[model samples]
Target: MEPPGNATAADKADAVETRHRAVLRKFIVRARRVEEHSLAADKERLLAWARGTVTLKFEPQSGNSTMTWDLPEEESLDSLAARCRPFLLQGDPVYHGKVTNALGFFLRLAPDELRNYLREIRESWRPLDPGDRETIGYESRTGSISQALGDLVTDKELAYAWLYGDLVHADDNGEERLHGHDIDARFQAGALLITNVAVKAISTLNLARAAQSQNYLTLEDSVFTERVVARPKREVRVEKFATAPVGTPPAEIEAALDGVVPRPDSSKD
Candidate 1:
């Protein structure tokens, strides 16, 4: 959970250049294998990409649908929190309250923020006069809520840290060396992502509410109007084999693929 050096200022005072160096070091280590090339240029190139930011964009779509995309460096915390408040309020009293507080705790928001937010929504609530038939079943509510949670935790990649509950670092060494404040710092960064997830969840909840406001539809019957879609992409940058190509095998093929340096027979068995 170490903080990103410079692109983001929310979590730490760590210099961006310094953080970039560390990230590059790790990136270089991973990118080193399966290729024989100088990394100075690649280091600079990838560092530039790492130094970039992540942003969230929202657009209105047809038929009550809203679309959201996370751009390179522009997420709106205000928009995120606005989305969370309404969605959390839709939940049943006990569990929903706890989830709200959990978000408050992790995101480091004011203690009463969740409570106050829910209260405000309630105060603002007015039952539709077209009403008596406007009701959604528990099964419909749960199903829709579950679907919304899935969207936040997966596909969108917004609540990754929260969903997985761990530090996500890619290393050839397969070791997580972060300790102490580094963990909290990264958690802070993740909290920012969580804010976006909360908003998306709220959007789904609104869709369900829309269906509920109508005569015959239950939550499950609600048309899904809001969606967060990530463009599918696949890139094959390198290809390396543990076994040498065809019949001309290199002696170091196994070692290179295993990433193991040869061990001398220093200790006799």
Candidate 2:
């Protein structure tokens, strides 16, 4: 990656500057993707599900009698984890590590400049119109971007613990770290913290866009395209099952099955 031996000092300087700009551009791209993923995630809905605000109802398919069961805490956590997996999982494009690393690069490139830019952007959003008093309250219900980033940095260990131990893979070390903790509380904290991280990512789009305007960076307009897509609607229904005596034949159970679709038979192929 070194410049040619005959290259002049000006050439070397230009090359290095180009490389640094490339880093900023890369960070901008990743930050944009994080925002896109966050939008699709629907932060409020995920938070509600993670916080157990939504009642989870399910019917057993194999039980001898028809009944509805409330989803257990473990299952609820699993559902929440699935929604969170794309944003926090290690290999995911929008993983917290990737987002943080990009922001770290921006910091490394120009520490004071980046801090100043963030402050300026946040303050710019501070002023509100006199007629907007109803919506603009004493403070934001969700913390500011700077606050979110600060919390994410301070609580990094907990973030990873939640990711590795509960939300994604069950690493032994992660589980050990989670030992002696209230499972639900830790999970709730982790989910909210993750949401904050997403907020940080989304907020930084504002910063990056502002930076581009100031000539601190550059980005394409297409990077900010609307990415959220509507999901197709589907119908949900409960299946009925009846109690049977012991030693019931498989044929009888198969005959009694209702609303059960048989899987494709692959053996013929």
Candidate 3:
């Protein structure tokens, strides 16, 4: 039969099904074996398997220290610290809680690094005692990172991290109480970019009149005109006529003026 056609279509399908079933059986068996092996293994082995695989070295420092990670060359330690500072100052309770918890996790993973950084921060910040409270009490009351930032940002306030600033006399015995710090602060208002257009309009007019009859009106017959006319036979008057050479409605003139003049926003002006 053509030597079984090398492998018939039906045979190929059967082979594929058999392989798939075999894989499923192997997976089932492996899972069971794993469960049994886990039960038989000692607590230490199981614990070791469950623990995180990555390892980071921690170098302790004296008094205060700086922990440098194997970071990219472009990144600076001060920049990293500054980035973390704002997160610690978030105002939302939820964000504050989450950041504090994450910091706790970092401490657990690298206690030496975290503690050293914290010590450095505390050393830089001044502590306050009840006896010295009067000196900077105003700052102590309202100088929070949140309040200071609010004054600058004009937006949502920031939360305070628990370990941000140091407390004085925290470990003192009876009568000596702990006092929080008053952080020295400065703020600058952002400049507003504004654009404005100014405009103005002006109009002018001239008029002339004429006298037609000397009997009705007189100009040259008057004593004031005697200097120019010299002598006049009789008191003469000449009729005067007047006509407007150019005229425009006051409202129309006002409307035209309005188009060229810039009106200020009364509220802001």
Q: Provide the TM-score for each candidate, comma-separated.
A: 0.20, 0.43, 0.17
Candidate 1 per-residue lDDT, tens place, 91-176, comes to 42312333333332322333364335544433322211112133111101112433432111111122232223443333221113
Off by over 4 Å in 3: 1-7, 39-51, 54-269
TM value for model 3: 0.17
lDDT rank, highest first? 2, 1, 3
Scored by lDDT, the top model is 2
Tens digit per residue, CA lDDT, model 3, 1-269: 12255888888766644543333232223222222332213434333322212245555654554532222112221222222232222352212223223233324434364445434432322211111122111221233565532222110010111112211113322111112222111100000000000000000000000110312112233222223212437676855433333684455456555553445459993
Residue 210, model 1: Cα distance from true site in angstroms: 24
Prediction-by-prediction clash tally? 10, 0, 13
Error of 2 at 76 (Å): 12
Top candidate, metric TM-score: 2
Name the runs in model 1 displaced over 4 angstroms: 1-95, 103-115, 120-134, 137-200, 203-231, 244-254, 258-269
Model 2 per-residue lDDT at 122: 42
lDDT of 3 at 84: 27
Candidate 2 residue 134 C-alpha distance from true site, Å: 36
Q: In candidate 2, which residue ranges exceed 4 Å CA deviation?
A: 4-6, 37-115, 119-156, 173-177, 226-269
Q: Tell me the deviation in Å of residue 269 in model 1.
A: 17
